[model samples]
Target chain A: MDILTISLVISAIHLGVPIILPMLGGLVSERSGVMNIGLEGMMLGGALAAVAVTFITGNPWLGLLGAIVSGLLSGLILAILTVTLRGNQVVASTAINLIGAGITAALVPIIWGVDGTSPSVPKIPSMTIPGLSDLPVVGPLFSSLTAMDYGTFVLAIVVWWVLFRTDAGLRIRAVGESAESADAAGIAVVRTRFIAVMTSGAFAALGGAYLSIVTLDVFQASMTQGRGYLALAALVFGKWRVWPALAACIVFGLADAFALRSQIVGIGIPHELLLALPYVLALVALATFVGRTSAPAGVGKPFVRA
Target chain B: MTSTQSPPRRSRLDNELRAQLAVPSRLSAGGRGGTGFGTFLASLGGTSRSVTAKIVSFAVTIAVALIAALPIVYLSGSNAQVALQALIGGSWGSPQAVAETFVQTIPLLITGLAVALAFHGGIFNIGVEGQLIIGALAAGIVGATQHLPGSLLLLASLASGMIAGALWALIPALLKAYRGVHEVVTTIMMNYIAINISTFAVTTGGPFAAKTQPSATEKVPLDAQLPVITPGTRLHAGLFIAIAVIVILMWVLYRTPAGFRLRLMGANPQAAAATGISLPRTMITAMLGSGAIAGLAGAVQVLGVYGRYFDGFSPGYGYSAIAVALLGALSPVGIAAAALFFGTLDAGAVQLQAVAGISREMVSVVSGLVVAFVAAQPAIFRLLHHLQRTVLAGRTARRAAAPVLPPPINGDNDLISAGLDNKEVL
Candidate 1:
């Protein structure tokens, strides 16, 4: 029981990293009323960039940073079109999503001379806190995690503080609510939104890094799969609140972990149904409960200057 | 917070782009088409802006799209060139390639037209993809399993496909009419339903499963083939079907009482009702028409391309068709050309991957670029407006001096401007 319990917690944490980073990343973009349908693409770019950089430079931290940079770059494009250029967010983001899938797959074999997959790298090492290593379940859970994992929880708190408490947060809120009003108040509404979306790129990049460097340990074509989208759903499920999104993400991660575990343990649950449970839950949550959990007012539609 | 791209922060992207957009005259910047015909062509030229603004915005949007697409291109590596060659070779290097592209695009053209008609009518039908899938399933089951004469089998299969698509659309149409639920969410949800249902039927060997793939449906009866029009190519008689559908669509849109009713309902549902058009009937018919055409697209693909139903046979034609329809500027002739262009890219993707050492996905990036470029039509108009006026002014100057060698084909905006004058105010 203890061993199973310990593994469950570890697995939950493992799944949680990919979920949380994207969740927080999505929170920032949607917080500013820019519907980032490109989260999937961002994660894909980050995963490929992380693996490519880590393989090239013998430094995993630099690899993580590269992923963040790639995400930021991609996010910049999406923001320019949707925010500044005032293009259709859904179509633009969907294009980005498709483009991300294609470009990452296209460049992988060229850059590293590998076939649509990255060269192997030593994974970002797991850091177990000293002396605390022998502390039973708590030790196993807390101490023996990658730096990425530790950073995520810390980042979560920081994101919560920045999003809810800061003046910048107030600006983002105002930009989302009434771009006209925000501009009237001299809030640099476009600039604040531009910042929010671009910063969102870094978070999404970290989410991608967590997948390639920490979780999967290598990049492959179409990596990050649908988790980025699932993370987006979790953000909505959590009602766009940071801590609640994290908690909702943990639940989703647990569900995913349970399904993966069930497959490993020779459980005979039907593959289709097992594969579908999480998505079904997400769709249901989106359709039934998401409306109750309101989005920023003035979402999706463009906010032209008065 | 916005970090500039590395090394040099503000270096301009290297591509020189001209803003290419059409503006119908007598319009508020980005809103609907102009209400008059006289200045329609004039407005099509748009207002003049500084060349610097025009070039930079064009460069910025394209650069942005390219950067967004880089991750996928990054993954393709060596196979890209090979894929590109194969895709181009397959799509347009030969007469067969050209014909095949047209053949493949025919259904997409019809379906895209279907979507455009509905969009113009104001019913958002994101469910076209699902409807297409369902239509394919229906056609497969009817065409493959039934042993009838060629003409009957083909007709029945096509009809079945249309019914399947229309029936699938009814769910959302009804929901929107009565429940106040947004069709966007339901249509997107229905995609999963269509995918899962098709996959399940194929995998489980329920009537339509192919004997060879086991996961795919059996081949359609030989008699059910959509006959080839061009002898030496993959081009099929479906081109006629598509053109016929377009004619029908044009008539229903511009020349019929029902089309007017659908347009009324679409333009303003509340106002449409005040004008005495039945709300439920018009809304449902518009959706059903849209669904049936999309269904025909799927059914045609199955009969014309693989001759059998496979898992994911549609390859998201429904989604791509939106670009096709919009690119065609929501006209039948326009959509046909746009669909052909998309078809060439899609068909050429394999060659591009195989020969150009470019990833097969570059086609997607290219298409996505075109769609984004097209969607920002309003922005493009402003940047090009100055150049257009200069050309028009120069044309007028030349007309006064000599009989023009070739009368300048009046530009697109001028035509649109003239077109705006004919219609009563919205």
Candidate 2:
């Protein structure tokens, strides 16, 4: 029981960080009606950039910031496509994903000064709350620290609040539901969409930062792997509402935890099958809600002034 | 907001854009003409388009794409001159590089053609990757274990790959048809499933795994492997087969009745069904044919290129094929050219690394830029329409007799979106 509990908690923390950061990213662009398929690439690019930057600067915080900036740049390109040019969101997103894969594979050598692997670096510092420190299993939450772990919880609630309670949120949703209506109502649809996409980049970058700083302390090609896809699935499974989306991400986190525990406990299951579980479950959940759930309606489509 | 308030001439450019870009969905069905082969021909060559017009339009598009590529290349390097030299040399510089370019393009062209076919038939076979991986594994295993004569073994590998690809697609096809589960999501999920399964069998438990590359399956027997088309280059016989397949596709698409049915279904399945076309049989066949073509792409990759199955040998060739098929405008001839073009880029990537000192990531950026350009074609078309209309208005005012402008494209209409142009090879 102790083994299962500890394994579950670790897996949740591991999978949760990747999912939550990307979820924040997805929430941004998706909320604004741009389908950010390039989240995978952004996460990946950020992951590699973080490791490389950390290795060079020997500063974990700088490395984390570098990852965020890289993601922002990727999101910026996406903004250029979906916002300025009003191109197909899905197409632009796919291109970005490909860019991430090819870019990371190529940069791995140049940044690391090695063919495949990079030098290991120091980790991000973790902190615990003063009074909450002596608590049981939850007290050690601050032990294996990365900067984004604390930020994720804060951002989730803040973003949810900013999305639902603020005037900016109203305008963003208006742009998503009907750009024409939004434009007539004096909302800057293009500007809002662009900001939303840029914010998405920052969030996805944080996900990458979590990996380089908190998760592994290094990077590899496509290392962000299909976690980006799972986050997207979380967005869909959540029906695009922020809190529900986070909840969906937690489920994926648990599934990831399940796989990790199976591995640690010698479950005798194949690694391939274990890795395949989250995706399979994602598909099942997605399929169950396939036609039932609707996206922002304008998602994957480019909006133009009439 | 201020732009809309400008003078008519300036705002008229906006008007021209707004005018040209109407919702095609708004076109009432009353005056709609039949979209059959007769319409296809009329739309292709019998309308307002002249050879000069076609040539000019295509040239302008290519020029714009290249011009857009300039900034990207410059940003990719500080030493632009060296980058250019390396880019050209590394990609087209050596015989081996050129061979590699063409070699890589073969499976893409074939798989792209398959995708084009199904998309044209209005079935989205997005599971091409899953199908491709399975096909490659099946044939690789067959080629490695079979003791048959060399020639027969080659034939068997190809068959097994095709069958495997076809079989992989069967479930999604059924789900889409009966369960009403959209093939897009189902196929994407299946791709993940298929990839994992293939990885598992080849690495740990698959019956035909090798001892040397214990992480992957065994290589095919030497005799069963594809012969080289070019004696000194990496280019293999797969190129010839891909070309032959393209020719076969063109003939079937334009000449055969079954081809007629596929096209008919593609244009409008409901209408085709109303006219007595068999929806189920036609749908199933189109899907199977698409699977087979994608399967062929896998067979060639394993037998002609890799000679063994490993994880991710494709490097997204199946997905790239989708872009190729669309860029080719879903024609067999077009797909071949697009495939070759993409092949050159993949080839140039190595050159970028070797000569320009630019990483492979920049090549991906270039590719994304190209696709971005392709997706932005409609917008570009609108821009061109504005330019042409303005120019024509000037010319006609001076002459007192200008020809009427061509109609603008409606973005809302689902007219041959190359994104959905999932044209693997239909």
Best model per lDDT: 2
For residues A31-64, what per-residue lDDT tens digits would candidate 1 score against the true structure?
Answer: 8878776787788889988988888887888899
Q: What does the lDDT come to for candidate 1?
A: 0.69
Which candidate has the highest TM-score of all?
Answer: 2
What lDDT tens digits, residue by residue, belong to model 2 across residues B1-426? 133334554344333322222223223122111122212221222112333443443445445544555554554553667766776676678788788888878887998898888766656566888888888888888888888999899999999999998987876776655544445545666777778888777775655668878757787887889998888887888888898889888767755667767765655454556668886788778888888888888989888987887777877777677667656656686678778777777777777766666665565555555556655554554575567767777877777874554233332222332212111110
DockQ of all candidate complexes: 0.23, 0.37
> What are the lDDT figures for the candidates, one per model?
0.69, 0.70
Q: List, residue by residue over A1-306, the lDDT tens digit for candidate 2.
A: 354475477568778878888987898788887878678888888888788788888998888888878987999889987778666565567667766776677666655556555678877766766767666665555454445677788899888888889999988888877677899999999999989998898888778778766878778767776788778878877878888788778788887788767766777887777777877887777656655446675665566676
TM-score for chain A, prediction 2: 0.94
Error of 1 at B241 (Å): 3.3
lDDT tens string, model 1, B1-426? Answer: 011321231111100001111123223222211111112211111122222433444445445554555545435543434444576688989997889778768767877887777765566576788899989888888888888998899999999999999998887787656644445545655666677677767876454567677767888876688877788877887888898998898767655678766654443344446567887788788889999998998888888777877787776677777667656656576677778877887777666656655656565566566556644544455345445656666897776855433232322224322323221110
Residue range with the least summed lDDT across 10 consecutive positions in model 1 chain A = A270-279
